[model samples]
Target: MEHAKPLLNYIRKHVTLSEEEEVFLCSKIDYRKYLKGQYILQQGDISTTQCFILSGCTKMFFVDNDGQEHIVMFSIEDWWTSDLGSFVSQTPSDFNVQCLEASEVIQFPYETIESLFEGIPKLERFFRKIIEQAFVASQKRIIQNFSLSAKERYQLFHSKYPQIEQRIPQYMLASYLGFTKEFLSKVKKELLKP
Candidate 1:
């Protein structure tokens, strides 16, 4: 299916765009598909594209000094994926973006987004708002990390993205929640008990 409507509506909700402008913005993006486990980006690569997840799931994570994976974010259907700092600064990415399931996404080059901002000033405002929301969510996640217990963190995550929680894998969820697999299983059992 053409995810055009959902994508267009996502944009329209943030800023009004003429038919011509919508099509113009859409024209620059390349729609592509990836199998589960495919890597959209890897460490040390200068990422030049920002992806809009149209279907399935994707995750962004980094391997630390000890080579343990720490998930930064999970992008489900309709979410955007990219290492923002790297993409904006044209620097090598520290994280890896991997498809967690067969996925379809719209990939737009950084320059295209820059040009879109120039042509549609409202887009700049829309993205600024997006960045603000991202920042707020990041702060909330950090607070939750320190203040909430593992079970509470899992519950809060469910509250925020029940649908996403259902769709992704438990290990990935465990990684995101900063819990061991067995601990997450215990948490799930607690949640499942009547």
Candidate 2:
């Protein structure tokens, strides 16, 4: 219940919810604690739930044919994480969602979400807005990857997610920026200079 407060507040930012509605919403949520390095969702598994981070961080990534891991996104406290394609289609996920730290999350099953949307129409709008934001962010990331230099990408990442930079390892940050660890180190050195 206490963990639900952050999620409730986040939803309230998009729509007003009565006390009864809030209680109903919270009742459907399931809580889980994940140890560091645990996988919440793995490649090839159907993603049946969307998760809200109550505390700690997670990385969503995929392994390539050459067996290199590509970091797609990082979700931290108060953020939502899911493989949207798999979640909506009930298909196997290509991405793996793994805990970067011992973490707590509140999960909503896809079936429960559908029931909520039908019973509480306003929630449909809330989720729509959340998806819209996610889409815009994804588009921005794509554009940045194609148009921005590695140094520029690193700078933008640092500016946008300073807290995450402190929490995650430099190699993960480098991967997210589509740069080698050596390149990221060079960028950091340049950034430190006057």
Q: lDDT for each of the candidates?
A: 0.88, 0.93
What's the true lDDT of residue 91 in model 1? Answer: 98
- Among the numbered candidates, top lDDT falls to 2
- After the best TM-score superposition of candidate 1, give how far the Cα of residue 89 lies from its true spot, in angstroms: 0.5
What CA RMSD would you report for each candidate?
1.7, 0.8
Candidate 1 residue 115 C-alpha distance from true site, Å: 1.5
Candidate 1 wrongly placed segments (more than 4 Å) = 1-3, 192-194
Off by over 4 Å in 2: none
| Model 2: colliding residue pairs | none
What is the Cα-based lDDT of residue 21 in candidate 2? 89
Candidate 1 lDDT over residue span 79-183, tens digit each = 889888999999999999999899998887987888888887888898898789888988999999999999999999889899888888888899999988899
The TM-score measured for candidate 2 stands at: 0.98
TM-score of each: 0.93, 0.98
